[model samples]
Target: MNNSNKKRWFKKWWGILLIILCPYLLFLVILQSNLDKKKKIIFLALFGSFILFIFLITALEPSTEEKIAKEKKKQEQLKKLEQEKAATLEQETKINELENQKRKMNLEKEVKLKAETEKQIDNEIKQSSSEILLIVSNDDKLFRQDFKLMTNYLADNYSYDSILEAKKIAVNNINKSQYSIEKLKNIKCNLACNNLNEVKAVFIKLYILRIDMLKELIKFADASYGIENIATIPEEKIFRRKVIEYTEYQNKIISFFENIKAERETHE
Candidate 1:
């Protein structure tokens, strides 16, 4: 009869009730001789109907324990789903970080590649120019060509139709090759080669070479400026002074080159 308990259609409760009730009713029949048979049958039918009703109610209701178990299973599934979502999010974050790092590295490499390419171009330019000047200085034909051009510009009142012979006469007392414009230009070019100390040496060589080249131009200007003869023109004095100054600079460069070369040879 308890709602919390379960029961089958026919089992121990029904059989026990029949066993005890039947005997009790028989006892009642035997005790009261005046009792009617129809009254006993009615009493028995009422008791059977009440027990059947209780059995049906007990059998049809759902169990509390099974419902609790189902709720627990549903909660566990939700918790597992939440954990899987968290793991997926974490994995995605890690992948994004890796991709960012790869992108950064690629960008750095691109910038570095561009910088190196520019540096290589500048180096090639200097190297090639150095080679050209060295060839111009060493080739006698090229040197003579520049010399003739410079001399032709020298419109001195007196004809230097044989300027080569006259030039040989003027420089006979000194080393002509060392003080020549071509040799000084070559020294300036040699600064680009792998033969000297870096910045300071290149600056010094270039400065001195400029003087060497400039003095020769000054000589042509002095000769061309006035129609007067060499004896009367004060320009002759200025030209000779510049020539001396240029000669001194040439000596300085030659000295540096010779000293450095010797030092390198000694160390080797």
Candidate 2:
């Protein structure tokens, strides 16, 4: 405190003196009231002892200012604890919300990826379907027999040399056709599958018919090559069988193309 305040506090000695005497004065009043001498002495003794204890306790006890300071410190500590608890709960709530947001974002990403993959697969399927039809259309013209070219040598005559020459030319043509068929078989569908098990069912049917056409072509080419006597070798029968197989496979290809269109449209 400043010098003036310190002087004023020191001047309160009379107040201290009055507080010390107040308890004794109260005890004396109690002793003087109506009572037997023995009871009065016992009560006086107890009262004196209580007065002594009060003096000792007052001397040892903290000042009023100290009590106020301690109460303020305890209130600050309690407030700090409350603030810490609130922060912890808020932080936990934020963490839970962030985790929930992350899960939702992951779920959305997974769905988007699934949809994109399906779209890519559908595009591949449609392109593969179109390519397959185009390939089949090419084969129709590739295998169409040109009898005029084969029988061109007959204009010269029905002689052994002429017949042999025509047969040799026919064999060469058959060899070329076999090479072409091999090339055709080499064509493959490079398509992304959504469900291979389902797509495979359709492809398998197409593949079976293609295989049949390949087998017939092989047989026809071999029969033509084995022609010992053109009149009796029945090479024309082999050609006719090839034509029938080709026609059947062409029909299946057209049907398959239509089916693919229908299936895609249904999904749309």
Candidate 3:
């Protein structure tokens, strides 16, 4: 054929073939139509048949297989992209769930820790109250002992001015009177005047002295007890010094009473 005739032939027929086959091939690819072939040779032969059909009907042009391959590759790439997107979404969801669970656990732990701490504090407060009550009771007993001893000394030496002076000092020092003071005063007046009315008045005064002595002694003892308790683990030297100080104070007070008792005995 002449080149012009061939060119015309190629242009008209090839253009027609492309118009007919392109849509059909694109539809097959779009629908993902699969043709079963048992062997590689069979697959190639099927592809060659489409090429031959196009060649016979029109002048040689681009084959349908290349377009189909490109479409298939594009579809595969899209499928891969969809799979990756789905996987990423799943991972993000799992991560968010894990984070929420971690936050919940941490919150629960914090709540539990707070509750435990409050319980410990409450127990400590109760323990401290109990200790204070015990210490107060001990102070009451000591006050009673001191009041009884001083009263007995006075009763035996009522004529002595020193005995009366001691009573005046005790009354001045005491701030309030309770049961012990009333008893001590009654005993004192009975020893002094031998009158029933005076004896009754003495009882009231003793009661007042008892209450006053208890109040003052508790205040002092509480302060000393707190200081000593906080220093429970103090150095041995510091402990010894505190002990010595307490002993010296006790000895001085005892010596003063002893001198009073001795003077009374000599006069008698």
Q: Which candidate has the highest TM-score of all?
A: 2
- 220-254 in candidate 3: lDDT tens per residue? 33333324332242332343354345445445545
TM-score of 2: 0.50
lDDT of 2 by residue, 105-205 (tens): 99999999999877877766665555444554454344344324435543453344554565555555555545444444444444464343354444445
**TM-score of candidate 1 to 2 decimals:** 0.36
Give me the overall lDDT of model 2. 0.59
- Which runs in model 2 stand beyond 4 Å of their true positions? 1-56, 144-191, 194-254, 261-268
TM-score per model over all chains: 0.36, 0.50, 0.36
Model 3 regions lying over 4 Å from their true place: 1-62, 144-268
* Residue pairs in clash, model 1: none
Please list the C-alpha lDDT of all candidates, in the order they appear.
0.52, 0.59, 0.49
lDDT digits (tens) for residues 131-231 of candidate 1:
43343235334444544554454444344443334344334312343344344344443323443224234434544444455454445444644453544
Cα RMSD (angstroms) for every candidate in the order listed = 13.2, 12.4, 22.5
Between candidates 1 and 2, the one scoring higher on lDDT is 2
Better of 1 and 2 by TM-score: 2
CA lDDT, candidate 3, residue 254: 51
